[model samples]
Target: MCRWLAYMGEPLRASTIVLDAKHSIVAQSLDSPLGAETVNGDGFGFGWYPSDATPTTEPAVFHSIEPAWNNQNLREITRAVESPLFFTHVRAASGPPIQQTNCHPFRYENWMFMHNGAIASWPELRRDLTVAIDPSLYPQVLGTTDSEVLFHLALTLGLRDDPIKAIGQAIRTVETVGHAHNVQFPWQGTVAVSDGATMWAFRYSTSGRTRSLFHSTDVPTLREMYPTVERLATFSDNAKVVVSEPLNDLPGVFVEVPESTAVTLDGDGYRHQPFLAA
Candidate 1:
């Protein structure tokens, strides 16, 4: 398993959440009480869309096989770069070897994606799933992890047209392939995707028990709830964040996403809906 954090609305230095928050994503890389593994030191990644992004513009990504807390560059980059939309992940390798290419927040064109779970018996199902990817998009699958392949699969089905539906389709595809191999719980994880303007996060699995995920309460609401908290001043009313776990212990600051739900974040506040129907 892994831990991930994503933000949309109000540009601010990513370090405010990734490095400086109470239980920052980088800090979680060292001691994550919520992650399946206590430590997620296998690797880390950062992906962000610039403030001045056009529809055709793609986000920039930085990947390293270094532990998030120990990487000097990770510290510097997060401190310097402020993005309206971005994702950061710290990995806890389930089976794949630790390498830069295998890092999360894999990118293709204008979209950025990352996942915090695994495909059961990926080695057995990889072949079937890989071949299902669109030939035009197949060449972009650059990592061995099931995540990158999953992203491409979504793109193949219809992510560009309808992200929420495409992701459900991709997960169903994985389950179908896994059922063929007799993998009981074919897929599992929390996934986040963004195409510069909107961010989508999904919490689902074949078995119904998916990874933990939470989204922050709107900043204005938080400010009213904790008026004395100075940190609350840094954010705008529209700021919304989705994370694998709460960034802090503050009550009402974060809400758990219901199981099998998809959350969409844009100019609209977080909208939650059932993703894969039973």
Candidate 2:
């Protein structure tokens, strides 16, 4: 129901993927080819870690209710800043009101999270999920979106210690609660989270029909494949991006994440593992 991108490489400006690419996030906000919603103009947001940030420093965030393509300030600010790790999102509100507080890439301390999907029958499951959130983290929830709620739920479940395990537990909890409410297929969509260091992206749904998600092909391979593409040469081989959809149409440039899989990206590289395994 929305679109997002997570970049965990090279200290490049956010505009590189948010604006400059062929089918950029901004363009997808206007006319997405792979999204369930064609125009994700409800709002947009981005969170990035400074190149020299310390463990105590929180990542900077910019969220606005303006459409990505029409937000002049978003362009000005993102173009002026550069970070090695960043998360950008263009929202298509499923049920929540359109407001800045409801924007994606929600933050807590050094962590940032964004999502592009919905909690099926959220109205019925909201109370159970909300009550499950650790009381310490409950006071931090500032929006009504299911995405933000899910983020805090993961944190409360131990996101800071083990993101993959915490998230798996969170999803299982959602499924359990949903089943209790007679709601089938409780969760759906792609989610991304970062702690200003490692980045993680998950693609899953209760029915195994999650939204599209992909990671860029290795830069070195792309360079060898398209020697004349000047842009490919600029990226470091370790550069990685996990996006809701391909930023460009180049064949073999992106690989679709398998259903119920979780991708992890760090200084070394990117790798994926089964997300729903018990």
Candidate 3:
């Protein structure tokens, strides 16, 4: 499994959350209490849309096979860049080998995606799923991991037009194919995605028991809840974050995303809906 986070709202240096938070993403790379694996040091990646980028502009990415905590380049770049929307991921390889291409937060055009779960018996289903991808989108499937394949599958299913439905359809296809192969509980994990503006997060699995995921309470609410916590002062009222784990110990600062749900974050704040429904 892996630990990842998505942020949207006021522009802030990526390191503010990836490196400087009390229990930042980089810290989770070495010690994650909620991730399936305690240490997600297999590799890491960062993707963000520059402050100047339009809603459809492509995001820039920085990926490395190095552990997030040990990568000076990540620190340097994160500290130097600021964005209103960005994704950071720390990988704990389930099966795929650690490499740049295999890292999470895979990109396509203006969208970026990352996952913290796996396809049960991926090797058995890869061919059937891969062959289903639209030929036009298949070329962008650069890595062998099920995560990347899932992204391309979503694209083939119309991610650009309707992200939430496309992702649900992608998962549905995976489960349908898995059932044919007699693999039960074929999907497990949380996923986060964005298209330079709005951000979406999903928590689901073939079984009801999915991975842990949470979204930050609105900044004003958090500030009132933790008035003395100086860090609360750094965020704006509209700021929202979705993470695989709570970044800090503040009791009400983070709200757990319900199982089998999708969360959308934008100027309208966070909205939740049932995901992968019939």
Q: Judging by lDDT against the true structure, name the best candidate.
A: 1
What's the C-alpha lDDT at position 258 in model 2?
95
Task: List runs of model 1 lying over 4 Å from the truth.
Answer: none
Model 2 C-alpha lDDT per residue in residues 107-130, reported as the tens digit of each score: 999999999899888988888899
Best by TM-score: 1
**Model 3, span 157-237: residue lDDT tens:** 999999999999999999999999999989998999888888889999989999899999999887777788888778878
Q: After TM-score superposition, what is the CA distance of residue 265 in candidate 1 from its true location, in Å?
A: 0.5
Predicted candidate 3: what Cα RMSD to the true structure?
0.9
- For model 2 the TM-score comes to 0.98
For candidate 3, give the lDDT.
0.91
| lDDT: worst 10-residue window of model 3 | 269-278
Candidate 3 has a TM-score of 0.98
Q: Candidate 1: global Cα-lDDT?
A: 0.94
Which scores higher on TM-score, 1 or 3? 1
lDDT of each: 0.94, 0.90, 0.91
